[model samples]
Target: MSRNTESPVDVDEALTHIDSRGAKIRKEQLERTLSQLQADSELTADQRLAVERLSERLVDRLLAVPRASLQDAAQNADEETIETAMSLFE
Candidate 1:
């Protein structure tokens, strides 16, 4: 009979390591993007701060609500609201 090469614990550990690495990479990317946005000379400091705060608020809302609730809210949003939100991201 064929035999397993690795134990289930080993597989779980490898997956945990992969997840940690992915999270670290995402955190680094977010830091770089935030730095770039804050360093933009075209925007006043206050404007840059406002943009950052708006992003943080959106993140807070996401964390506060269930995924389905957020999805439903997005789906139900009117065209003007959707366009405004999309434009802000762009």
Candidate 2:
């Protein structure tokens, strides 16, 4: 039997592949992708840092949404839940 010797995938390489697709992924999808990359055992220290920074940027953008908009979207939701969501930015 022939043996396969392919190397494990790198996080940066995976990111490059995703970026090359040129399709806009939703924030939640991107967050899930990044979380998967972060969990990869082959990730180097730099790759882990990059993944963390990207996650932070995503969270920052999410938290930047106007409070009024979030409130409107979550109509019927309790005020405490809305405030808890907004507090993630702080």
Per-residue lDDT for 13-87 in model 2, tens only? 333333333223444566676678767756787876676677667645653444444545355534444444434
Model 1 C-alpha lDDT per residue in residues 28-90, reported as the tens digit of each score: 655787678668756677875776566566554543333333344455643333333333333
Assess each prediction's global lDDT (C-alpha) against the native. Answer: 0.47, 0.49
Task: Measure candidate 1: CA RMSD.
Answer: 14.5
TM-score of 2: 0.33
Quick one: best lDDT, which candidate?
2
User: Which residue runs of candidate 2 sit more than 4 Å off their true CA positions?
Assistant: 1-35, 38-41, 67-90
The lowest-lDDT stretch of 10 consecutive residues in candidate 1 is 7-16
User: Which stretch of 10 consecutive residues in model 2 shows the poorest summed lDDT?
Assistant: 14-23
